[model samples]
Target chain A: MDDMTTKDVQEPYTKHLLHYFDGTSRYVLIKDEEVPFPEGKLIVSRTDLQGIITHCNQAFIEMSGYTEEELIGQPHYILRHPDMPKVAFKDAWDTVGSGVKWHGYVKNLRKDGRYYWVYATIILNIRDGKPVSCTSVRRKPSRTQVDACTALYAKLRQAEEE
Target chain B: MRYVMTVSPDFPPGQIAGWYIFNTWLQRQLGEHIHVELYSDFEAQRKAIREGQIDLIYANPFDAAMLVREEGFTAIAAPLSKPDEAVIAVAVDSPIQQVADLKPGTRIAATDDPDVNLISMIMLEPADLSAQNTQTQTVGTYILVAKQVLQGKADVGFFLKDAFAGLSGMIQRQLRVLVRSEIHVIRHVLLVGPRLRERHGDLWNLLSEMGENDKGRDALKNLGLQGWEMQTQEDTEFMIDLMDTLVN
Candidate 1:
């Protein structure tokens, strides 16, 4: 467990340093350890149209449990758990693609199959003639909101799978 | 006061220059017995209608639905042009050539007004299109979405056909239509608040009949070529269906 935790910590920084030289990093720091894991802090990489995982910070790797090498070329959905609904992601994508911010609750899966809930905000970065990348930040969500969302998402997921 | 009926945001308020022209003409017809107040935003106009701020509203199908559902406003007439058809487009160079080409991880751009644009997009869903793994961005306007797609910022965009009329040449040369909706009668509907329904039945009848003469034709021309038509529960039902699809 200790080895795994240590690997998680070093992997993200190494990945960030290797892929992104601009000194910008994606970091997710949990402000309260006592809070539920799903309610903790989360930071995601900013990527361009090619979907490269250019940068990640320590907290992202620690929580996701992937080595730096495993995360870099993978699409963001690699972290997507099976429990999430396709429509929620569809809605989120549609919202951000239009150059508007999307605020919603999400349930993401960890590498270990544990699920977490987050209050997520995503924004698009347009530079020059194209969209450079999108950045997202997530924080521990209210239990009330999560509980309601989980039930709704479960129904939506079931419908999609059917 | 003269009553001004304005189409909600679903229609091109800016393009519908006829509404103002008609309002001025209608004022002449009414001889100052009533005044017109035109509005483009549905939510704002809905609030005004609910609070008894306006005597009449020229609303879209969706707005008319909300009025019937929540506030008991009566639909008086629908516009001549069908408002339900939404055109989905992508840059010519984009990999998305058809709705089926939209795969997981595809980045799609849409307008911020989900109730209007998003609902229209949903109505245009292809039989085999699955929205899995799609990432979407919601800009506030159709033009912004077009600019984004033109600049290669987004892979797809959805907007009304009329909204893109000015850019048709550029779009035809640079972009491809992924899908086009069947002709649904999109209308700018006339609605009366519950309080004014009985009191103003004659006004409604007169307005509907006004298009039979030169003065009426001029007034109709001013109101975006929308002449007076009868209101029906069916018109209200169409709007309700749109609203239901939006929420679901």
Candidate 2:
């Protein structure tokens, strides 16, 4: 997967074993930093059916610290934060895959290894009478909402660990 | 104090700015005695219902049916969506003029709601298509699904006639309706929980009259609804059946 380029990643559903840096290293680096999502600005991205990054707006690219070229052919999960519970992603996939739009607060890992929180809505994109890809629109979340999600997510992640 | 809540799960929590504004206006119209709260979180509202904490609740057919069937909630009022039909739409310039023209693997998009999704499922049946044969995306909102169709991301999109009617001019002009379902019932139903019914007898009549006056009319306009009319057993039953069928 490391050697694969844009041409190779374009094929949908190319499952790659994601080795998270936080999980593998002897001493994990934690950048407990927060970047406020610009108010009223939408951060948008589109992924293929298999969750490969297809297109992203400037806000998404800039926030993630990845260039458009770097992001276009990569897996969308590259920006996934470890703090998020697997159940959240599972629910999100099941909901949208079953033809429901899903809304949730997501904490994302940036390219700089810092993290940010967003309230994201994931929807399915269909064309020519078939399911094509999914798009996610995200915005800055309120402090109160984030605090609640933070507590909820911690409980969820702990449950998974047990 | 009486508690009133509304569920629009498609919207994100804390992001329902306009909806919150409209609810606040409705609270004022309902007078100081009634407290109105709009919740976009399904789980939270469902929990409240299970605990018998909520009084009057507004919800989509699926949730309303669940509340009615299991929790002793009564459907009282519902919004009357003019031209209330399920519609399938495609880009105006797309060559696909009919449902039969759609090939296997064609992408169909609609809101994530099961009732709304069922419309597309039923429409695709004429072409001998099922869920497995087609790629379906559940969009978060009707306007987004319409936008997907117009942007060529989705070949087809499904939304109730009222949602299509509410589309922005930019979206409406870019897409054309491919087909429409027969008339359907109201999308959202207002229900009074047992606790509310026990305390507030005949509250339905008062709530149903919300659309009759000027302040309520202005609020409804802001909320993008036409009017509230009392629901019938037939209307509630039809919606409940649709919800059950989707579940089973």
Best by TM-score: 1
Q: Write the per-residue lDDT of candidate 2 for residues B52-159, one digit (tens) a residue.
A: 777777676667767877788877777766323577889989999876677778888877665556655656654545688888877667878987888788889988
Isolated chain B TM-score per model = 0.79, 0.79
CA error at residue B156 for candidate 1, angstroms: 1.1
- Candidate 1 per-residue lDDT, tens place, A33-137, comes to 122442112344554544456655555676666777777776666566555676787788788788777778877645543456666666666434456676665
Error of 2 at B39 (Å): 3.9
Candidate 1's C-alpha runs over 4 A off are A1-162, B1-5, B31-42, B112-116, B123-135, B166-168, B183-186, B238-246
True contacts kept of each: 0.00, 0.00
Evaluated on chain B only, candidate 1 has a TM-score of 0.79
The window of 10 residues in a row where model 2 chain A has the poorest summed lDDT is A8-17
The local distance difference test score of each candidate is 0.59, 0.68
What is the alpha-carbon lDDT of model 1 when measured against the actual structure? Answer: 0.59
TM-score of chain B of 2: 0.79
**True lDDT of residue B71, candidate 2:** 88
